[model samples]
Target: MSKVVINSYEEFERLLGQQIGVSDWLEVTQERINQFADATLDHQWIHVDVERAKTESPFKSTIVHGYLTLSLLPYFWNQIIEVNNLKMMVNYGMDKMRFGQAVLSGQRIRMTAELHSLVNLRGTAKAEIKFFIEIEGQKKKALEGIATFLYYFC
Candidate 1:
């Protein structure tokens, strides 16, 4: 998939309130979930134990951790947009984050983002993007939130 390139802060400002783009679908595999669990030291049975999850978990399968899914924001965002002429970029923060559904392992998910707000703070650009992480073929979104980014345009 092609990325939407924003050459300048002005161009990004013009796209305010519009959906920038949707990222390509990414599969949430068991391996990824296991790695994430190991990295974060969150060895929950519901996430790593396949057999136990199948027998006891409500989801019927090992599900991806909510934080693991949230952590994909940067990777997914890069797939959707590329900001040019930037000296650096920082993950400012997130707000109103909601996990609406569990992402089962092996499910495909993609992110759709809209420009919620943008402002110029000196030479830096503060961008707030409202994002929805959707599970393939599901009616409910896996997660939704506003992700803030600080761009230092050179």
Candidate 2:
């Protein structure tokens, strides 16, 4: 898919309340989940133990870390849009975060993003993007939230 390029605040502002773009599907492999578990020091059985999880967990498989999926926002967002003329960009914050479903290991996920709001903070642009992380073949979203970002355009 082609990225939605935003060279200025004006360009971004025009797309408010509309879906910016959807990202390509990314697989949630057990190896990735284990890596995330190692990085975060959260080696929960539900997330890292495959055989144990299959026997005990209702999902019957290892699940992806919620934070891991959340942290993937930047990767997915980059696929959806390209922001140019930028001196820098900052991850501001997240709001209204909700985990609607547990994404199992081996499940493919993709992100759908919309420009929820945008404001010019002096010379910087503050943007709020509404995002949904969808699990392949699932009706329920893996996650949903509004992500805020600060765009510094030169």
Candidate 3:
């Protein structure tokens, strides 16, 4: 999908209350899951130990970490929109985040985002986006949250 380009805050504000876009599907590979485990030092058996997880896990396989899925927000968000002429951009925070389901390794996930609100804070813009990370062919979302970003446009 083509990115939704926003050259200015006004352009971004225009998308309020609208479903901006959906990102491309990204596979939750075991390699990526293991890498995240190593990076974070969260070597839980459900995430890193493939053989144990196959027999012990309710999902019957290794599952991706919740934080690992949440960390993909930026990657997925980048796929949906591109804001140019920015002096800086900050990940302000996230609110009301919930993990609805476990993402099994090798499953594909994609994000769909809506512009929840946009506030002009002096010269900076605060954008609140409602996002859902959907597992392929699943009714339940892998994760859902409202993410806020601070953008300084030049």
Q: In the order shown, what is each candidate's alpha-carbon RMSD?
A: 0.7, 0.6, 0.6
Which 10 residues in a row give candidate 1 its minimum summed lDDT? Answer: 1-10
Tens digit of per-residue lDDT, candidate 2, span 1-154: 7999999999999999999999999998999999999999999899998999999999999999999999999999999999999999999999999999999999999999999999999989999999999999999999999999999999
Best by lDDT: 3
Instruction: Give the alpha carbon lDDT tens digit for every residue of 1-154 in model 1.
Output: 6889998999999999999999999999999999999999999999999999999999999999999999999999999999999999999999999999999999999999999999999989999999999999999999999999999999
Against the true structure, candidate 1 reaches a TM-score of 0.98
Model 2 misplacement above 4 A = none
The 0-to-1 C-alpha lDDT of every candidate, in the order given, reads 0.96, 0.96, 0.97
Worst 10 residues of 3 by lDDT: 1-10
Clashes of 3: 0
Q: TM-score of every model?
A: 0.98, 0.98, 0.99
Q: What shift in Å separates residue 103 of candidate 2 from its native position after superposition?
A: 0.3
lDDT computed for candidate 1: 0.96
> Where does candidate 2 clash, by residue pair?
none
